[model samples]
Target: MEQQKFEKMYLMQTVQKTIVILRAFTKEQPKLSLTELNKKTGIGLSSLQRFVATLVYEGFLIRDDRTKQYQLGLSLIHLGKLVEEESSIITIAQPILQQLNKATKESISMSIIDGNERRCIMNIESSYALSARNHVGDTSPLYAGASAKSLLAFLPQEEIDQYLDEVAMEHVTENTVVDREQLLEQLQEIRKQQYVFTRAERIIGACSFSTAIISNGRPVASIAIIIPEARFDEEQFDELRELILHAKFDIEKQLNK
Candidate 1:
């Protein structure tokens, strides 16, 4: 217990140090030398050198050899753009998601790619007492559910191939697809249809209908309606499909604007 506590404190200190090092570079001092950074961050010069070197190696900071100064790197710009896009997507899709949730009285959600996983960025709970439950910030494997597969289906062919080759496919539930070739085939079909409907692939008692939100001919996010299996009506599948697709269209239309 003592060792674990010490390790946790050490990790926290390392993270805080990293944040301080990055914060040392501001508009007033966009470029800083190791000495300047050490002074600004109040870290020892030796420790600061290690942190700055690691940051530079990771592309979070760039060092100018001639001037011996460091500045924020392109990776930070890319991360900033991603943050802006996620915020914009939520703002653009909120009303459409609200309407869809109201129409079906089921849980509605939006997901985006986060590394090799799909992350729920926005979610509206179902109105019914016995509805599917998913929370904002929930994450799931891309091979599992309608919410995940919708985004995965729209990725570039090479990226899709890379992901399939790299990530281990695990069955989240008995119905989850763990076969690579079968999953590839299913993704192809989803691409052709531009939507996916799945049952009990992630959560055991849930069904979801999902479609990608496209911008500039590329998928940026996915929208989903999640329903409890007990509440799902096969007879109403077509109506639910239409509502989800229309929600997709409306959100994408706004995204393209």
Candidate 2:
């Protein structure tokens, strides 16, 4: 092949294979064996072996000797942030998120939309572990999760349609919504309340509350809290919702001026 064509070929394969490898890291299977990766990705064993080896060498994945699996590595984390937005939203939100966590005694997080997915941008962990599986940089579908749903409730209907068209609904738990009409109705209610709350929707035995951070006529991000079902009651939800709305107001106020 000519040099130009070879460069293009390499770029295309690199893009395709990189995504395939990255998609292997899920909340449940953050660690995976080469056999598991091959099974999950449907890639040929030899190709997967070569690619996995290269990824480990390049510092994108690491081998866990005790678990006999591979997980994301620090190199990826370092590179991921460097390539991400200039300055960190996490740094900006950390203080406020920590205050919210202290006030609610819940696991607080701030998430923003990133390429059709909602990415957790910051977190303030609770004394009790709440949604330990998700932290900064964790991605979730645009339709599910309280933070995502908070964004969805305020997002343009066209984007919502595009997301529904492009992504299939995955049943994270029994409470996850699949019916379009029902989801829309729920979204309407959330809009009316200016916040979202769900129980066992994205993760079993966990519930979340979220409010959108609207700026310049668009949802710029969301603030959410993860609370275990047993620890919080409806009255407690009311208090947290008020705090989230206040946080949204503060963010918007800062962005506007």
Candidate 3:
């Protein structure tokens, strides 16, 4: 009975309950009815109704007048726009990404390590049909991609060892380096060059290049570009490298203000 009261009290926290409701809708399930949301979230109908009422009032949620189906509202778009505008790095890098797209016609992406996973913060759509679009909230492994390696290279060896002990490399692909020695060697190269590049390391036909976005002598995040392995050329790297460096500097400069 005491545990039940404690759990119920904690569940009353608005932010915590909101996430439980909202996260139920994903790319596959983009909308849900009140009953469905309550079922999926396992919250009582009465309690869920009250929470939904608050969300609807706050404009974080909306209901269809005809069907009465509930979904995320325009307020989320407003909040997202505000986040994009307020983020120093994203604000500065947006135009730079545009300029890069014009110059290379390839997709560029930015990623940050969040605990044990990597989160893509910003990305530009690729013009080519063969190119892929990495979404902003997409999560990837910290040992799987060039951007992940760039982050690992910047972190201390002790930290890396501690992480490796838990993540025991399971091969995501035939090309992924599972051997600790080889991965350490790659990290060393990234540390020396301030960048990481891999051909078909994460995906069989895809290649990527990543660089650390450093501010105040520390890597705050990583920036990367993905290109088809068949399309990669050493000569093209020079132009892309310059553009990426400029973008990194612009983002860091915004931190000064």
Clashing pairs in 2: none
lDDT of 3 by residue, 1-257 (tens): 99999888887776788889878877877878999998899988999999889889989888887887888878888778545543866767678778877777888888877778778888888888888556799887788878788888888788888888878786767878888888889889888977777777777788887888776555667888888877788898877777777766777777655
- Model 3, position 29, has a per-residue lDDT of 76
Residues 73-141 of candidate 1: C-alpha lDDT, one tens digit per residue:
988999998888888989989998999989998999999999999999888988999888668889999
Tens-place lDDT per residue, model 2, 171-195, is 7778889888788898888889899
**Runs with alpha carbons beyond 4 Å of true place in candidate 2:** 1-92, 129-133
True-vs-predicted CA distance for residue 107, candidate 2, Å: 0.8
User: Candidate 2: how many backbone clashes?
Assistant: 0
lDDT minimum window of 10 residues, candidate 1 = 129-138
Q: Estimate each model's TM-score.
A: 0.95, 0.65, 0.65
lDDT of each: 0.91, 0.80, 0.80
How good is model 3 by TM-score?
A: 0.65
* RMSD of each candidate relative to the true structure: 1.4, 14.8, 12.3
The runs of at least 3 residues in candidate 1 whose Cα sits more than 4 Å from the true structure, single-residue gaps closed, are none
